[model samples]
Target: MPEQFIAEESRSIGHAGRRELIAWAFYDFANSGYTTVVQTTLFNTYFVGVVAGGVGGVSPGLATLLWSLSVGFANFVVMFSAPVIGAIADIKACKKRFLLWSSIGCIVSTALLAQVGPGDYKLGMVLVTVSVIMFAYGENLIAAFLPELVPEEQMGRLSGYGWGLGYVGGLLTLLLCLGYLHWAMQQGMGEAEAVPVTLLITAVTFALTAAPTFIWLRERARPLPEVSGERILAASFGRLRHTFREARRFRDLIRFLMTLAVYQSGVSTVIVLAAVYAQQVMGFDTQSLIVLIMVINVTAAVGALICGHLQDRIGSVPTLAITLAIWIAALLAAYFAEERSQMWIVGNMIGIAMGASQAVGRALVSKFSPAERAGEFLGLWGLVNRLSVIVGPLSYGLINYWSGGNHRLSLLSTLAFFALGLLLLSKVDEARGRAAANNFLACGDS
Candidate 1:
């Protein structure tokens, strides 16, 4: 915590290196395949359209609500498990081991998704629940290692590369899946064939891409200090308790988390709902939806790359402020747009801002936390994210359900979240958070 130590830690960034940064970013690429193909595009649509039944056959509102709730349920399980496991990993300095176990869960869950059949609603939902839980938890664990690699100032740009790469990975996966789906359809395959085939591809993608983390990632070399058998269990619980106790003192993080909960819920809801809105509201065909998503992902990749540098130059608070304003406008446009083309325009704008918002947010958290306990803090951040996934969809579902099945009002609700977060964020001091990050890095030297 001394000034000399802080200066030393700051100086080490150039020497401490870029290999860790590359490895960290590669993890994003690996995980994004599942996020794009399995969770977002293919599986979610298949689950709701095929298993839960289509919007026409079932109450689309209810179907969506169920999917959202399922993700929420899965996230809740991760929320409880993640921080404790993270704390243990940190305490044991066994980040690599944790990554290995979590990645296995991710691969297995994706494979299980392929086995789900039509009308197997129960089985499909269960698979979705477990798959997302594993995926999210693994991402959280991987993120905990990031601050150990980069300097405080470079975090925004590094996070941007990771997020941008993730979008690129996601875009690639979606394109491949679309191509396969198109070929299958051309071969006289039905909707059933497209869904299962896509799921299988996702399973294979996760299995193959997960190898890099195990092979390339290196943790700081430290002795494996011994502890009593009973202490391990006690330490996990103690860490969890300490996290909650620590929250009272870290009021800024608590405030940030609260804002993130509301706004990110809206952000994630929009991401999940965009295709549905396009399909049902705009009356776009499947091919058009895929094309639109591809466009958005491409734009997002570009945006993330651009904004990642901007975040470093101008700082995260300012970058976040601008992104939220853009989101507010996009939500308003989605609510009022009369034609399909307009949706594409708004989607492009949303895509441009999405990666930057998330990448900067991740960097912000990393900037504010104690270096050694990054995983524990990220666990709380994940908790908010998962909890919001529950709230956003449920709210959208309820509003749509109540409005005689109109989604316009549901889309409008996002404005409230964006506005609230903007207001709260106005009060956050990014400079202080940066200083805290620097201090945390200094702590590492001790």
Candidate 2:
């Protein structure tokens, strides 16, 4: 491998190291094309209006519910498999291979989503599910590589930058789709035809953006000192068992994870539900939702950068607690916002807090996990991260289903997660918690 491709953690950040961070950040740019174009705005519109035939005619609401549930289930599968895959990379010395395959899966799955069309509800759902499953799995595995690339202190900054890049990426893709839509209209194409083509472009963007990650990023997968005659599956199970057994050594890490699971669920559900709430319950038109999302993304970029720097300075747990408090307030405000403009204001506020909460949370995890098993640990983190979505959105789905499709109560119920997470997070001691995490890794290696 070329020297430029190798991601040496010691040399990954600083004035000289910014390029590496940029490369890392670029991954978000590529992935967000799929997120924004397919997951959030364009595809959801297409799925409902075209595939499901809108409300009272197959209802886009049903498709959205299935999409969320499918993503959650796919992550569950990846969680069960991650430790084994991660353990093999650790033992067989194939970290890059795993990352490569995972990225390819994301690219292929997303691009394939372009193939399903109108009147193909079942097929479209299957394609969307498979694509998101691949994307979720890839995201979990790719996250593990970040710790291997950057220095400990700067992890927060890079994580923020990655999310910032994601916003920028999403913006660019949205712009491209807008251009395509305009062109299609000029050429006398109906809205349906224009949308399918735009969806295809979204998938293409994922493939193009992901190319560099495969070509540029490199991992050394430092060799483990302990030798094992055991096969990969046995070794994975053994390490997983040990991780649980030794977790008692780091009681604070356990507390932190539990706290994060609860609060972050609130955060995750809000992000997932906001667009839907805006379109459905809030009664915002398509153009209004687009504008609001752009505003949110821009503000979110600023939020992530500022909050991330503060996290590095003040402390992760404290920063997170503050952000969660703000989130609780934001959700409450959203629940009551009567005017459309007021809802938009609430979204902008969410953007501000959203970046900080998510970026810092990931940075804190990177700060704790052993660099070698970062992938496996992150996989577990992804498990809880995804499980929250399953529980939060599914409950919301049930509410929506039960209330004769009333979305307001379902949207408001997410607040319970924030309140619960706040209580649990307060129990965590930051300094002692991180130290315990390090000690666990030391004992494992010993």
State, as a TM-score between 0 and 1, how close model 1 is to the true structure: 0.92
Estimate the TM-score of every prediction. Answer: 0.92, 0.90
Model 1, 1-446: lDDT tens digits are 12443344346765443444566677788788787776556677777677776623566666767677777788778867877777777777777788887778877878777777667777877888888887877888888877787776777777788888888778877888899988988999887766677776776776676676677777773423664466876776787786677565566777788888888888877776677677768887777777888888888877777778788899888998898898898888888899988988898888887876788788888888777777778877888787777777667767877785687878877678888989988778877765655664576522
Clashes of each: 0, 0
Candidate 2 C-alpha lDDT tens digits along 1-446: 12352344335543224455566677778887787777677676567567765532565556556656665666566656766676666666666677667667766766666666777767777776667666666666667777777766767777887777778888788788888887888899875667778767877887787777766666657655465566656777777777788787667767777887787777767766677778776788666777787788788878887877788889888888888888888888988888887987798788888878888888888777777777667776776676776677677766776676677788767888888888898887878867765676677672
Error of 2 at 159 (Å): 1.3
Note the Cα lDDT for every prediction shown: 0.75, 0.72
Query: Once all C-alphas are superposed, what RMSD does model 1 give against the true structure?
Result: 4.2
Off by over 4 Å in 2: 1-16, 53-56, 59-64, 223-230, 441-446
